[model samples]
Target: MVSKPSSAASARTVSVLALVAAVLVGAFLAPVVYDAAAPTPDRVAVISVDGTITSYTADQLEEDLHEARENESIKAVVLQVDSPGGSAAASEQMYLAVNRTAQEMPVVSSVEGTGASGAYYTMLPSESIYVTPSSVIGSVGVRGSAPIGGSSNEIRTGPDKASMTLDHREAQIETLKHAFVGSVMEHRGDELSLSREEVAYAKVYTGARATQNGYADDIGTLQTAIDRAASEAGLENYEVVEKEPSTRSGIILLSSQNGNSTVVVEESPIGYDGVRAPQFLMVYGQVQYEDEVIGNVSA
Candidate 1:
């Protein structure tokens, strides 16, 4: 019942529909385009050292540290520690990795609960170390159980195959202890009020006491450490990226059967190539020894 629309009106209608479609598309894409144009924020990496430091833990931490070093977006690092420490070799590896990362950029440490022995060693390279008031720090020394001896009936190819001499074990322990103490002195000597002899005593210090004695820089939370790290990197607006240790079913630190002592089990089998080897620990808790453990056994 109506006349056909004019060609001119149809053209106008087509133009209007095209305009509306363009507007709708633009509205959807504007935010995306803006996001693409924006710069990425600088990042502060927070690497955690939880539970006992093992070979596996050390490797994971090293990977994180390496990532932070290689990534241009990452400006600084915060080592978040909540461990009683672990294997001597593993701890040393962690320390070396941390030290290398520190040389490249600012590295700060925050102790959440306990950072003792090897944990302390691992944080030595940090520019500043922070701890909570209740945090435990220090215990810078080494202890080891004597090697298990072969049975009298067992045959050995070499004199040292079955067991290392007591004197040799003692010497080895002394060497390890000296190196640990020396590293502590090298890093914290200027601030320390305690002497080398006192440090050799291997005492665990409360956070407050540690700060006063120069084992820790100040009493602060993990957030505080992150802020400090960002500040050190000259980042006013930065993002924090946390790298957590891999989860695995291994005994970390557990109370012994008697409930009075603690046993630190590393992720690596307690030995060399699956053989039950002597364990040299830079740990804070009381260690339980097996019958194979020689020397003055503690219960």
Candidate 2:
């Protein structure tokens, strides 16, 4: 045991000490690196849906919803709706996206000024809906003209090819109505006191009436909605953040290659060319240039 240490044995001891030092350094710096790389996981995303809900608004809502889903920091979603509804197609798109996100996280819809028709439809997908005492909700109906039909002076084609017939138009109206009714039944079924016919009748209600009839969860503000969402999601501590969604415009092309091929393309904004087909919309507005109501299309 008193023999002099060999050079090889001394070199091995030095190498072992260096290895231990490296491990200690890594342990000390690991948390710093992780903290810098990862965002704080105490955030809730709030997306605003103000004014008329066109394709543009739908795209924005979709962007925020996706961000909330992909980002681990986001704990829940709150849809701040202040719309009088718009094109039914856009509302449907928003509904589907919100519903999908709700499946992954808690989503609460909070009404601001008005959430009627398609706007209400968009909110239906949330886990719960919140509205102030003054908030206006409901108007679950479609508003659009029947498809236009042209005479034989045009190109030779099928009878109902240019436009749907009277019967066909009626069927389509029924289809839209049934779709709205089906969604209402599915989303607000157990809590809904109103019948299928009553809802399809397209009646608007105040926040108090809406909550009384089970159309809305409760009468509260956006803050209330956020607090409730956090509590329901088991988030004892969190921060509410309003995320700015991308506003760039783009075209969405959908193509089908069946025997009767059909290609549909839509723009996210009002096109320069006034070319658009009649859309089944849940819009509730009076047409007017300044103050006077035009034809009073508030039906």
Candidate 3:
């Protein structure tokens, strides 16, 4: 016959089993408890594009976008835009910069006040464009002062030194317009309800109209855009780090009722350096005028 085990041995065994179970439960819950106690969120970078998009502004914004791309901590980017657009070449530069950044990570654009012409062009590569009810967008076109006749006594190295013919200027304008419209179609074609020709009309639409016409995404605030960008980056917990550009006084170029345009060279945001030259502009609103005005195109 076998002897029965002692009651003390059974009690000790039960205690050991209970201790093992407690340790298992603690191991499972430690990470959850630590996460809840000190939450560390991902980061989203906010870059602002205010005022006219001149070479100076484009340079600043491009640098910011480059930084966001290189920073491993920045999971996403939100472009805070509020501008009427400016210099065509500068705008193209911005477009390229934004496109490059978007390729690496998620990029979203938020139009605050007016995002027309070149400003619109810069945001083409964004995954989504958020705007407020009063925000404006569109104006997909190009403009420039027509080439003017050189002085009769002025010596010229070539036949087109001072200015080109009207036909040549028109051709240049058409080319730029085609490029702008084509970019719009390429980026938002699937969502747009308007035709290429209609886009060429260069009409500025309100936020609601822009959404309906596919020029913009759903109506949302700047914060909403930031949240959307974080979501797109697959970040449930995130923090926004705004990258503010250097501040400088700006010269406001206003167009009078009589169709006259005036530009102040001093501290001008357009970066013209006080010289008005005939150059293609992807911009909306009033224009700066020069003596040899071939044409002042606008919407």
Clash counts for the predictions, in order: 0, 0, 2
Best by lDDT: 1
What pairs collide in candidate 2? Answer: none
Candidate achieving the largest TM-score: 1
lDDT of 3 by residue, 1-299 (tens): 99988999999999999999999999999999998997456799999998777777899999999888888889999999998888888899999999999999999999979999999999999999999888889999987765557557778898767546678878988988898899999999999999989999999999988999999999999998899898999998778999977764543232322332233344444555554445677778875432322213121
**Per-residue lDDT value at 273 in model 3:** 52
| Tens-digit lDDT string for candidate 1 (1-299) | 99999999999999999999999999999999999999889999999998766677789898989989999999999999998887888899999999999999999999979999999999999999999888999999987775446457778998767656667878988998999999999999999999999999999999999999999999999999999999999999999998866665533442333322234444435552222345677777864333322222211
For candidate 3, the clash count comes to 2
Which ranges in model 2 have alpha carbons more than 4 Å from their true place?
Answer: 1-39, 245-272, 287-299
Model 2, total clashes: 0
CA shift of 117, model 1, Å: 0.2
What residue pairs clash in candidate 1, if any at all?
none
lDDT of each residue in 82-134, candidate 2, tens digit only: 98887678889998998899899899999968999888988887888999888
* lDDT agreement of model 1 with the native: 0.84
